[model samples]
Target: MSKPVVLTIAGSDSGGGAGIQADLKTFNSTGSFGTSVITCLTAQNPDGVTGILEVDAGFLEKQMRAVFSYFPVKAVKTGMLFSESLIRTVSRILKEYRAKGQDFHLVVDPVMVATSGAKLLQDEAISSLIQELLPMAGIVTPNLDEAKILGSGEIQTSQEMKPEAISLSKKLGVPVLLKGGHLKHSAEALDILSFPNGESLSYSKPFVQDFNPHGTGCTYSSAIASYLGQGESISSAVGKARDFLHSAIVQSFPAGKSKTLNHNPD
Candidate 1:
């Protein structure tokens, strides 16, 4: 069977739990062929990130060219682009592809902080991400802190997420999936998907406790991209992805003192 090709532009996680590793796993699980463009490399484990090495912008561009030129990339998801130069390079090259009428769905996971509290995206790159990269996205998935940084007021509850998601969607001129996983006080994990046109949908599941996996964000966004690659609508993609992630978390097992998602849970 010929599967749809989904591309992930993200960092490499040596732990094999997040970033490019997670994205590829999710893509494969959700029935897509996965391709990658490495933006950075991280020496990290579930406990914390030890160090990072940013890929040169030229090499990043070359990777993008190699993938896009050869594969019929139906969708792309981006994670941890560490610098302003990298963000700009990605924006420029993707824009060039779009200019040539090569349409593909883009899922932007606005990854700022890693699960272990390491800063993935640099502060200076944030403005570039907002101005250049986000506008090209089909959807932007941001956790609570990321939403707050993306110009939302304090979001401490699921109810508070609605208005913030709406506002951010309008501000970014794209669909926003404001993730409520950080609201540890809540019994249910809630995520609000709001569109620029004022419509919204809620995706809620019982919060999985003691299951902090390293790659959940990377896996979730890539699952959405995989579904989009399979021609699902945005709302359907988000819903299905949310369910996919929930299942992965529920079936997770330990990996060297920290838990990692069971990407192939059957």
Candidate 2:
């Protein structure tokens, strides 16, 4: 039997706790073979991101094409595509793959703001993302801040989060996973998954008291995609993935001066 193949299209985290590094770690931990197409390079640590250098759109496309041309990718997850050009290029590739009847499961983590409140995506790129790529995504995972950015308002409570998830799913024409990690809460981290068919699932797990969790959002979405590549239903995959992320956070390591590194069982 061959291992399921999962590809991550995201940025390079030199800190080794987030972006492409974290995605690959989550994929491997979930029993999938991982591949990556880096969109940007960042100088960052647990404290914050110091700098960002985006890869040229042409080179980024080349990397994606190279992987798809040779590897049998079962699923693909995207994070931190910094520019409108990169988003459009990725949209084109997705269209090409679909036209060829290769409909790989796609998980899009709309990484607009960093953990330390730095704006990761360009202001002009948000509209392009919604117009081009959101509709093509199988699942869109947005943290509270990203959701607010997308919705143009604050989503601070679970009641406000539910309808917004459904509305975003309808607006984007895909399932929406509204992550509740950024909410000010004490009980548990609650995430809502809403589909276009009016079906919704809510997942909650005890929030680990680890302030050093750096790549948690990236890890969670990629873990879900890895499970989907292994033929699990979306709801079940998300539930299991949530459990996996909790474990990873619980066993997280202090990697840099301030942040903790996600554990990869690979």
* Clash tally, candidates in order: 0, 0
| Candidate 1 C-alpha lDDT tens digits along 1-266 | 99999999999999999999999999999999999999988999888999999999999999999998998889999999999999999999999998988889999999999988999989998999999999999999999889888988998777888998999899889999999988967999999999999899999999887776688899999999999999999999999999999999999988777677999987
Lowest lDDT sum, 10 consecutive residues, model 1, at 207-216
The C-alpha TM-scores of every prediction are 0.98, 0.95
Per residue, candidate 2 scores C-alpha lDDT tens digits across 1-266 of 68989999999998888899999888888899999999999998767889999999999999989998888888999999999999999999978977887758999999988887777899999999998998888899998888877772577676787888888787778898999887787478899999988778899888777557678889999999999999998888899899898878777665546537555532
Q: Best lDDT goes to which candidate? A: 1
Evaluate residue 187 in candidate 2 and report its C-alpha lDDT on the 0 to 100 scale. 73
- lDDT at position 144, candidate 1: 89
Residue pairs of candidate 1 with colliding backbone atoms: none
In candidate 1, position 60 carries an lDDT of 98
Q: Assess candidate 2 and give its lDDT.
A: 0.86
lDDT, candidate 2, at 9: 93
